[model samples]
Target: MSIQDYPSRLSDPKSRKTETFSYLPSMTDEQIKAQVQYIINKGWNPAIEHSEPENAFSYYWYMWKLPMFGETNADTVLAEVQNCIKANPSNHVRLIGYDNFAQSQGANMLIKRGDM
Candidate 1:
């Protein structure tokens, strides 16, 4: 067996990291608005959270604020996401749909990537 016969190493530093919707291209503002609408239609409370790139996968993410309970407007939720990104430009921002009945997260996705 020679090096030529072996496949390249699997450890590539340039490889992109994986997370929710990582496989898909970055979402646009319109696309994000659509998703927010879907969450509201599902009666899920929208919430924002952010974390440093290093802690992106940590169990605990810093909540932007209390979930927008009884929120019927998608724009309001999207605004909060923007606020979170502005406050934490160097951190990853995500939106979560909380199901009060299920008492857990029903949907989640990364809306912004950190500069670092």
Candidate 2:
């Protein structure tokens, strides 16, 4: 197949595309917990954000309250993720680990997919 033919296999343009992980199979809860643990171990602050499916690829996302600074408990971060999901059932929810030292995002992953 030619490179030009690749576009034909892609989903519709209007369809939702969250992030790199979206292309992979949906992650289980345990896997998500492990990721959260990894983020905490990296000394990154965890934050929850959500956006409409159409804006999934956009640079900005609505922050769920604020980032949990100095939060070491994985369960606490996971709970906030659930809260964001419940509040925005029709929007895509994501978890991001902000690196204060680097002043940028160190980790990002889609936790839930909204209705497309």
Candidate 3:
């Protein structure tokens, strides 16, 4: 996958918060997502899809920046996603926008990422 496809897969700007990565110097979107997915794969499920909008960022925050290389938080979840991407970078690196209600290949990437 090309570098251009990285951001959208890493985040849905229309709904996901952008500010979390603003201060994380040097991390590409791909790396950030690898971090998040690895976290998810480890079993630390963040507060997913909460009803109150304000609480949403908490989930986003967890997904966006947990699991850095030397982080105290790094563990199985981050390792799993990192391994998947390392195993197949081209397959895991692309994103096609799709909401949960819609069914399509775009959603498959998340499934493939173990994010869904």
Q: What's the TM-score of each model vs. the native? A: 0.84, 0.86, 0.23
Model 2 Cα lDDT, one tens digit per residue, 8-72: 22367444455678777889999999999999999999999899877776788999998999999
Cα lDDT tens digits, model 1, 28-106, are 9999999899999999999998888777656989999999998999988888888888888898888889999999989
Over 7-87, each residue of candidate 3 has an lDDT whose tens digit, in order, gives 433345333322434323545556656655554444433211111223333433123223233233434434554554555
Return the top candidate by TM-score. 2
lDDT order of candidates, best first? 2, 1, 3
Best by lDDT: 2
Give the C-alpha miss distance for residue 29 in model 2, angstroms.
Answer: 0.2
- For TM-score, candidate 2 versus 3, the one ahead is 2
Worst 10 residues of 3 by lDDT: 107-116
lDDT score at residue 45, model 1, on the 0-100 scale = 92
Worst 10 residues of 1 by lDDT: 5-14
Error of 1 at 35 (Å): 0.7
Which regions of candidate 3 are displaced past 4 Å?
1-73, 93-116
Higher-lDDT candidate of 2 and 3: 2
Predict model 1's lDDT versus the native: 0.83
Supply candidate 3's per-residue lDDT for 88: 49
